[model samples]
Target: MTLQIDGLTKRFGGQAVVDGLSIDIAEAEFFAIVGASGCGKSTLLRLIAGLETADAGSIRLHGEPVSGPGLHVPPEGRGFGVVFQSYALWPHLDVRGNVAFPIETAGASRNDAARAADRHLATVALQPFATRRPAELSGGQRQRVALARCLAQGARTILMDEPLANLDPHLRGAMERELLAFHAASGATTLYITHDQREAMAVADRMAVMSAGRFLQVGTPQEIYERPASEEIARFIGQGVVLPVEIAQGTALIAGQRVFLRVLNGAETGPRSAMLRPSDITATDPGAEGAVAGRTLSVLYRGGLWEALVAVEGLAEPLPVHLNRPARAGEAIGLRLTGGWLLPEAAMAAKAPRRAAASAP
Candidate 1:
């Protein structure tokens, strides 16, 4: 392993924000850690970078202990490049100076640092703006400068904390491409933290879903999206909505109607819940056999597709469905289920108390 974190723990205000968190990242791997806000993802990154000390556990890089009992390496000494959400560029310095500062600070001559910075800037396609200061550059340009600076430092491990969060949506795609290219060229072990699941899925070779300071599941983006470990993970990742149903002979009874679909995970015949993505559902002809009936509550235009909220009888929550054809509110629609991930009875029951408590006034 290139990076190993064991039994890591961090607390704030007497509460365990990062409780016993641990992860292993291989060398030259692009790994993303994704979760909602205040899930201790950023704090975990800070702990790994040595910006903040770990209350317990240890961090190892290349089999060398960096944070542990009586041994804490300074952030600068850890040889890890960090890209922050704010870009963190030097205001007074031009692009080249901002990129070269880290190198020069690490005992390199000014000329050598400038030469190395130029090469890195060209790699990021920012060589033309070398003489411009951070104030003169656009948000995306400044981000590239920050990335170039990290590359100039020659760190094999790159840590980014929502680096594209500050950029406009249109500019995020370009930066993501550059990041992928940079990783391919440098082969750095990157640990990226983001609340955006789409962004993480677009870039990471593997990602972990985190909640309340613990990883709920770790796997490829497809695996996590297709077969979430639990209902919370499915909802968090926007994979789909979990629907309560009765299963018997591999068929789920929805809205007093039996619909046949493949149920991922080892689910037996009983009362349970299953997560079905919007795409897995299709609108069929009225009164179609093996179809679950629902009324369209609303239809929303989502770029290339129309998204509709379906209200089915015998179900409390509305089902979200993405449609290729147009849909009208209050229209009768028959939903055909093609795929779903089943959650065992115990897991569904476990989530009931939490949901009840949350909805209580």
Candidate 2:
């Protein structure tokens, strides 16, 4: 393992922000931790970077202990690079100086440090801005400079905490691509923290969904999207509706219609909760067999296609569907559910009482 954390915990004001988390990251892998605000994702990153001490447990890099019982290594001694949302560049220094400062501090001559800085700047395609001050560069360009500095430091691992959160939507997309290229060029293990699930899915080799100081689930992006471990995870990772379903003989019964059910983690025959994504349901002819009748409750045009929420009989929440044409409010439509994932029995049990109370009146 390139990075290993075991039973790590951190607390503030008698509240545990990070609670007994453990994960192993392979060399040169891009691992992402995603969660809502105050879920302790950032604090986890800080612990790994040595910015904050662990109240309990151990942190290791390449079989060496960096943080543990009665042992704490400073951030500068960890040989790991950290990039924050603020970029953390020096205001008085130009781009080249910012990248070369770490090398100079490590006992490199000025000429050697400048040459190494230029090489890393070229790697991020920021050589043109080498003479510009941090304040003079755009947000995206400054982020690239930070990445270049990481490369110049010869860091074997990098920790990023919402590094692109300050950028506009359009620029964020562009910088995401730049980050992938930087990771490939540097060949360093990366631990990224983000609130945006979309960004995490786009860049991660594998991701963990965190909540309330613990990891709910960890897997590839597709696995997390297709086979969420709980109702909360399904609702948080993407746009979806979880409906009560009855399963028998490998099929699901929802709204008086039989649909194919992909059993992910539960018994094949029983009452369960089914998570239905937009891709699982499709518009069909109203009179088609096995099609459920519904009313369009709302619609929004999303670029080339239309998105709608459909209210089906016997279901509590409206199901989201993608349409090739416009749909109006209160219009009648037929939907065929081709596929869905069944939630495990534990998740259903955990949520049943709250749902029963909510629907009581």
Name the best candidate (by lDDT). Answer: 2
Model 2 regions lying over 4 Å from their true place: 265-267, 287-289, 347-361
Per-candidate TM-scores read 0.91, 0.93
lDDT of 1 by residue, 1-361 (tens): 7888888989998898888877778888888999999999999999999999988989998889999988899998899999999998989999999999988988999999999999999888899999998999988889889889989888889999999999899999888888898888777889999999999988988888888998877788888888776778888897477887778866786676566656654436877777878877888866898788889999999899898999988788888898888989999999887766775445553453221010100
Provide the overall lDDT of each model, using Cα atoms, as 2-decimal numbers. 0.84, 0.88
Q: Pick the candidate with the highest TM-score.
A: 2
lDDT of 2 by residue, 61-126 (tens): 987999999999998889898999999999999999999999999899999999999999999998
Question: For each candidate, how many residue pairs have backbone atoms clashing (under 3 Å)?
Answer: 0, 0
Model 1 residue runs over 4 Å out of place are 260-267, 288-290, 344-361
How many clashes (backbone atoms < 3 Å, residues ≥3 apart in a chain or on different chains) does model 2 have? Answer: 0
What value does the lDDT take at residue 138 in candidate 2?
91
